[model samples]
Target: MDLQQRINAFVQLGTFLREISSESISKTSSSKFHNQIPQILQAAQNNNRWFTETNIKFAFASWGHALTETTINSWLSSYSITQKIPNTIAIIMAGNIPLVGFHDFLSVLMSGNKVLAKLSSNDNILLPFLVSFLVEQHSDFKESIQLTEKKVTNFDAVIATGSDNTARYFEYYFGKYPHIIRKNRNSVAVLTGKETEEQLLSLSDDIFQYFGLGCRNVSKLFIPKEYDFHPFFEAMFNKKEYINNHKYINNYDYNKAVYLMSNIKLLDNEFLLLKQDSGYSSPISVVFYETYEDLSELQTKFSEDKDRIQAIVGNSGIAGEIPFGKAQQPTLWDYADGVDTMKFLVEL
Candidate 1:
């Protein structure tokens, strides 16, 4: 009903997620939600093979850490948030990783607005189930959230996320409305050949987490010229278990085959492929590398192509560069595309 009530409900949801994440849901906890965890997890994996239990749980764990009362208050404190008439905001979600569109959903409701969400089929299970948990926390939330299969209309504004092609469609259809339309963007890492083994191993998480599907996943690397691949490959060895996922292995094999057939020189570690490329987006099991002459030049390049890049990960001193391994662990205010979702909603 009110902002505090909404925040309280989400705090409850966060506690539930933390319990599930830690495998410590007490017997006296909300039995219905707790009992449904296994089914929800199974359905998520069944619906999208990319939604492995480990990754889904990690997503939950990340959100659990994020939705604390202190953090939520701190994030929202910057906005005025005084809307007398709530707008119905439609959200087009992306299922690349678990709950990828949740920030928008959270923003709408927290800003005293209704949500009309079109959940990506690949991620349909988790958010709706969590919505059920939230509604139970406060019945008022039921009227605030709507999940739909038909064309989304009767909304005051739109926030859509999709590939570059779908973005064109979104632009054609929803461009007239107050909107934020996002397209394909990738994250990259800068390796100065000075990172410690621990840092490199952590950086592997930035690369391989969610099998490199999320926009935040580091799909490219900027290494100094003549930087040996041996240490980098060795650090990545810690994530060799990713090869065990059949879907991931299939991509690795198929991409490797295609590259080999094309006569492209590749550095292979049996599980992952390293290729010299000038591009940012790489195949699922491959990471693109480019040699950098100077960090200042790379920063200038990133500045010029800011829209195409989501995050720059490293200690290269690039402005807003995320440290290694923390790309996926974005804070509540870490807007995707660097556009403030809360400001957009509040302004509406």
Candidate 2:
């Protein structure tokens, strides 16, 4: 498809997503397209423990706001896109969060690159359905997307997202091709003692969303020395229902028991567990924290380990940091792993 046709297809897809996102919270929509959402929700939950109804809806809501024509246009404005000979790009998706690798899929296609997707077993259904929807909107898309489960070959370049262990295999296997291979990374929040209750509540969104599975989810906190845990715990109390999810509660119980048996200190609020550690990647039910006497020193420490960090959430002017409550809502331009997929595709 041509550029406008490609843009229009995604715009229509976004409109369809929005109708299901905010208009009806109980899957009560009468639209033909909206009716399938419940089935998709069921399949997603059946396939992956982390893909709850609320989490899938939240993912769609973020994408719904992002896939607008205005936002797409603004994102593409910085690039000098031309009608180049398209090449196939293989995508190895990670199924940690709902529609986790959709951004890479969107980038490759919008940049005039064909896709050969090896869908993650945990998330194989939704994106293919979306591709079919795009095809229905523009038949030109029919030839552009090729979803498969076999090994990814017959592609000029690749973009793969996986854990730190899998990244080594990807590098060894796909290194010959131009590629962006991602590894384990986590997000952190920097807190000043003066944060308002509203800000702390928003910070809870960053920590609790997706059950803290996503790379953008705040898994660690950087606090000042002698910070009180009462206010922060109280603000995050609204998310107590998280324990209702059996999988999450299992992690909470298991991790909490381990901490107790090991004689480690932890601040607990029944649902979430807080331990003081220097690591960026925390467990599913635990968030690690550390004290920083100087904000500048902490900033410098994080800057040196940027490869291990996905995002930094704070109110301070800590270079390239994300504001509170915005970690999960990345723009099309906020490339994951700080690698510009658009630039990679256009250069291909």
The lDDT per prediction is 0.92, 0.90
* Strongest candidate by lDDT: 1
Give me the displacement of residue 105 in model 1, in angstroms: 0.5
- How would you encode candidate 1's per-residue C-alpha lDDT over 64-128 as one tens digit per residue? 99999999999999998874788999999989999999999999999999999998988999999
RMSD of candidate 2 to true structure, Å: 1.3
Error of 1 at 316 (Å): 2.3
lDDT of 2: 0.90
TM-score (all chains, Cα) for each model:
0.98, 0.97
How many backbone collisions does model 2 have?
Answer: 0
Off by over 4 Å in 2: 23-30
